[model samples]
Structure formats: structure tokens, C-alpha cells
Target: MKGRFHEKAPDDIQVFFPNPESEDPMKDEVMWVTVIAHDAASGAFLGILLNAPRHLKDVQEGDNVVFHLPPDAPLPVAVGMGGERLGWPVTAADSLTETVVRGVRHYRQGRFGHNPPGIQACVGTLGHVLEPSPQDAPADLRALGHFVLARCLAEQYETERAIHHFEEVLRLTPEDEYARMGLLAELSVMVHTSPDELKSGTELDWQERYLKQMATALERIKNPHSLELLGVIFSEEEIKNAAESNPERERKLRRIGAGAFRYKVR
Candidate 1:
């Protein structure tokens, strides 16, 4: 009646129970049970739930199944259950800084797609860092926090909020290439999604301003992805003119593009 369930799967274990009256357990009616255990300290009771199975198997009631648990096993940490599993350390001693770092890692790994729970977890973690005045926070932490917040908002299609966060990151760290990249990417989306708005002189001016900013950032950072993005945004004539004026820039762009394509194909 008392037993521990060994975690054979990621979160739960499956156990089959047969009718006590059945002579052969495998051939007769069997009850399937699913056990889910929290990653807590040892000596805790594992959660047991009955499951319905399409086909009956040989298992009998009153059958004693024994499972072993280490007496001093530590509670399992639940930090990396969702997303890209960046292997961040999650413990009782973890600080807000650590949680922010983990959330940033999740955002960078592109793990927020169609995963609301994971997104919510990351948002909660990063929100703690931003609850106080960001101005009082360390510059690096503020930049990182804003970047992660922007990324999470973008994932949820909260465009304006994401843009504000990305701009905050840039304000905190002017040379923050990631923030510039994020801002430009979001602006690009806005341009595509609202052609009528773009036609307005003010919106057009805003687009041009951000595009120039993106070009400047690309020139300084030379990030391959940013370079590719710039190439996509500019016309062939514009790129050719710029390349003619800056041959080295053109060469770097071509080299980065080729390398990116090769790696992607591989």
C-alpha cells in the first residue's frame, strides 16, 4: 500500500494494476495509474492518479510494486522545464539577478513561441527586476532587464510596449547592439503591417530615422544577422551605391551572408 514511484519519464511514472480475481494479470482487466511527483525533498508522498487505458493488460490488484528513493535526495529544481533548457541554476539561494539572466537566456534562445506558461514565467522573473525604479538599477542589469522584457512583449505581439522597453535599453546603454537590432526589427514589422500609417509624413520620418539608426548600428557592430537584415531592408541599388562608397563594408557583408547561408544549409 505504501511505495515510492521512480521517475522514469520527465515528470511522471506509469504503473499498471490488475484485477485481483484475474488469474493472468496481463490478459485480464488492468488499471493504469499515473504518478506525478513534485521535485521536493524526500519522504513526500508521490501524487497518484488513475488513468484509463484503451486496452487492458495483465496486472492484478493487491499487487505490491516497490520503488526506491534515495533517503537524502534533494528537491528537483524546476527552472529549465520549459523553453530551450539553458541549464540555469535554480535554487533557494537564487537571486533576482540570476532569474533575470535565466529569463534573458530563454529569450535569446527563441523559446517563447506558442508557450504561454513559459512566457508568463519569464515575464514574472523579469518583472521582479523592473518593479523598482530602473534608473536606480545598475546599467548592465537595466539594459538586460529591458531587453528581456522587450523580447517577451514582442513574443506576445505587444508591439508598443516592446518598443518602449527596447528604447529604454538603448537609453541605458547607447552601444547596446541587441537593443538597436530589436528596435529595428520591430519597426520593420510595424512598417509592413501598417502601410497607411507609413504613408503619413510623420510615420515615414520615423521609419527613416530608425532605418538610419539601424544602418549606423550595423556599421559599428557588423553582426551577421543584422547585416542580413539590413540587406533585406535596403534596395539593390541602395546597397550597390553604399558598397561602392565602402568596399570593405560590402566585403564583410558578403562574407557574413555566405557564411550564414552555409551554416543554415548545413
Candidate 2:
């Protein structure tokens, strides 16, 4: 019989049953066999049929038997089944969407603490599967994957990578407030860190232009957090003093600062 062993055997090896359509005389049989266990150093194996093949009872425990796997058999099932036996959760039965969903769940659960390698591996696998595009997966799952990846990168202090993923999340879901806020926060960090780079004339010019553009964008958002962030990146003192002289602008900045607590807490 041609088949593959399902797992390692000590005294008895469990083998997969060959397809019934094959030329084997016992094709209609649904029987299995446990090969007699041999020492690890020995290459010999013996098969003991569990059903129907009583004639094989004459076979000695030390007798060798050949097993063959069908050419058309799926390899993923074997690999996934083996991995499951070894304690990994991944399996051939899991779809790409299902894998990504499990990754997201793992990410969320480990986000607040030190993430283990397994969780990182799960999320990284999801990224590889989803990257370039989500293929047939749902658009929302893709967006959620990006969002989770962004947060993971951010927590790992990979700011630029995190920013890229966050931007991707926003591109897929423009109305995602959490991603928008995350983008703003990352931009704020970039602005905060740019002061040293500003000594270079080209970099200084770029910083100035970026700050102005972001300031305008924040004004359009009218969100208190964005406004507060803008005030920090721009000139908080200048705006506050100017507001004192201009009643209308003063009310606007004040309203923007309303309920703003991060800067205060810091």
C-alpha cells in the first residue's frame, strides 16, 4: 500500500489510507494499520492491519512495508495537520480572511503589553497576504489589517513604517477617525523631532512648508485635537497673543483648545 505516515511512531506508525479508485485489491476497504514501532536508529517498519486484512497476520512485527502517497493529494493538509499537532494554530483549512481575522484578534489582545513573537508572526503573515492588494478579501478586512499593522509598527517605534500603513488605512477608509487621529499624532511627532534637522537650510524650508500646510489642514478639520496639535507645531504664543487682539480669531483658537487635555497632561 502506498501512503504517508500521519505522524512519528514509536511502536506503531499510523498511515494515511490510499484512495479507493486505485488498482489496489483492497480499494473498497476503509481499514487502517499501525506499523510496529522500531528503534529511532533503525530504518525498518512493520505494518499491522487494524481491519479486514487478516492474511497480514502472518507478517512479523519487524517486516518492512512500503507506503505511497497519492500524487494528487494536497500537501497543505499534511503540513497544516502537522503544524497543528506541533501546537501552531495555522492550518490549511484556514482561509486568508480567517488568518487575517485571527491576526487582528491576536494584535488587539497583545497590544497593551509586550507582544510575543507568535503574535508578531501572525500579524506579519497577514501583512504579506494582504499587501499589494487584498485580492478577493473584503475591503474592510484589508483596511482593518492596515490599521492594526500601523498600530503595531507605532508601538515598536517604527514611526515611518507606521505612518505609511496609517496612510494606507486612511486611503481605504477616509472616514476612520482613529486612523486620522493616529496620522495626526505621528505628524506631531515628526514636527517635534524636526527642530534639530531644521539647522540644514533645505530641511528648514521643508519643515516650514509642511507646518503651514498641516496648519491649514488642521483648521479645516476644526477638531479640537487637531487644532491643539496645530497650535503646538505652529506658534502657540503668537496665536494666543494675536487672538487677544482679534476677538473673532481669539474665540476660534479658544474653541479649538476647548476640551484639549493632552498638551496640558504632558
Candidate 3:
């Protein structure tokens, strides 16, 4: 059975679901929970899955154990569930977003303050799943998912799939410069690299197609940084001509080129 949705997993780690819920419906309802494990090193995603609880014969969806509080804080501490501090860690007022972001920042920065696998995983999984709706997904999560999926696809050497993911990110966040840049970057690779480069007789050379598509994407992007980079690939004369031919594109490409120069220098 599928598990709940998760926003963002930890950085530099992969999560694994080795102990999935038991299939015996008679023992317990199918309790399932997606545990976000870290990479021990950089703490990126290991994977996610349902974890079976101790002493619970049957597992219902979204049912599992949680050992709240840092492991080294001291022995005999109480644990909390669903935001209630029934046991330890000295409850304090803070938004769930703040809490999760804090932990993520810590792990990513490698400034973790004595976070054991238990505490890190506990808070990491907090608010892990956004409301079951497209609108409910947090912007940062959406962004991260796009980035992660792009990286994964790229790793598999699927340039077009990776570019599509980045393009989706641009669609979701028109104002996001990084996402825009990423989309253009990946698209450039896809169009510039011909299938012949990869192997002919299978498909049209993607690199060549990507080169052709770059012009259209550059025209649409607002960020100047991306525009300038595209110009590097497209040539200034080509860009100038395109801008002259289409006023709207001319304005957008100018801004993109200007913005690209502004940031690309750094």
C-alpha cells in the first residue's frame, strides 16, 4: 500500500523503509508511517516507508513509534506525539514550520547540536506530509521536490526528464530565479546534445533539439542572469535580432540578459 505524502526529507541523506507494515490485517489495521532517514554524512534522503511499531501486531496506515527529544539530552525523558509533550524536552512555543526548518538548517549546515538519529528523524518527520491537496503543498517543498527530482533524473542521464522537472518548477514559481536558471540550463543541455552524440538511429539528436528550443525558452524567461547565459549559447547578435523581431521577447530577453550579467559575475 502507498504511504502518506512528505514535503521535504533531510539534506545529504536517503531514507529507507526496511520494516514496512505487516500484511496481516487481523493483527492491526494497516498502520503506515514514512520515516525520513538521513545520509549520516551530508544527510540527504535515504528513502521513505511505513514503519511497524513495537508490540503492535497489526499495522494501520500512518501508525508508528516516535522517540522525541535528543538521545543524549539525558535518560528518562518523556516523548511527545501530535505536538503534545506528554514526557520531556521542556515544551516551548514555536510554529511547526519553524521547528522543521530549524532542524533542516542545522543538519544542512552540519551544525547539528547533538541530534541523534531518533531526535533528528522525529522532528524531521514532523509536518512531513502537507495537506492532501495540490494547493496545500508548501512552496519550499515544491521547490525542493523539483530540484531533487531533477538531480535524480540527471543522475540517471535522462536529460529531457530532468529538464521537464525544472520547467515545472519555473511554472510553479515564475519569480524564482534559481528555478528559472535551472530550467534554462537543463533545457540547453537537452537541446545542445544531439542524439547522435548519445547514439544515432534511436531518436532525433536531443542536443541539437535543445539548441533549437533554447531560443524560445530564453524569450520567455524574465531573469536577466539566465538571459545572458542563454546569449552565451545563442550569441548576442542572435538575441538582438530576436528582440527586434518580437517586442515582448526583446524586452524579456533584455531583462534576462541584464539580470544574468548582474548575478553571473559573482
Q: Give lDDT per model, in order.
A: 0.51, 0.49, 0.41
> Which candidate has the top score in TM-score?
1
What TM-scores do the predictions have?
A: 0.47, 0.43, 0.34
Distance from true location, Cα of 188 in model 3, Å: 2.2
Better of 1 and 3 by lDDT: 1
Can you write out model 3's per-residue Cα lDDT over 1-266, one digit (the tens) per residue?
12223335321111112132345544332222334343355322222114334434222222222322233433111123234422112333234344433333333322222334433443334324221213455655555445444544443455666566666666677666665555555554443344466433233444344445455555667767566566674466756765768777665445333222211100
**Best candidate per lDDT, number?**
1
Which runs of model 1 end up more than 4 angstroms from their true locations?
A: 1-102, 105-110, 128-133, 195-202, 237-266
Which ranges of candidate 3 are over 4 A from the true structure?
Answer: 1-136, 148-158, 194-213, 236-266
131-249, model 2: which lDDT tens digit per residue? 66555656676777787776666666556666677788878887666676666555544544544653334534544543553554664565676565656634667557647677775
Residue 105's lDDT within candidate 3 is 33
Clashing pairs in 2: 2-68, 3-67, 3-68, 11-37
Model 2 has an lDDT value of 0.49
Work out candidate 1's RMSD over C-alphas: 14.3
Residue-level lDDT for 211 in candidate 2: 53
Model 2 / residue 209 / CA error / Å: 8.4
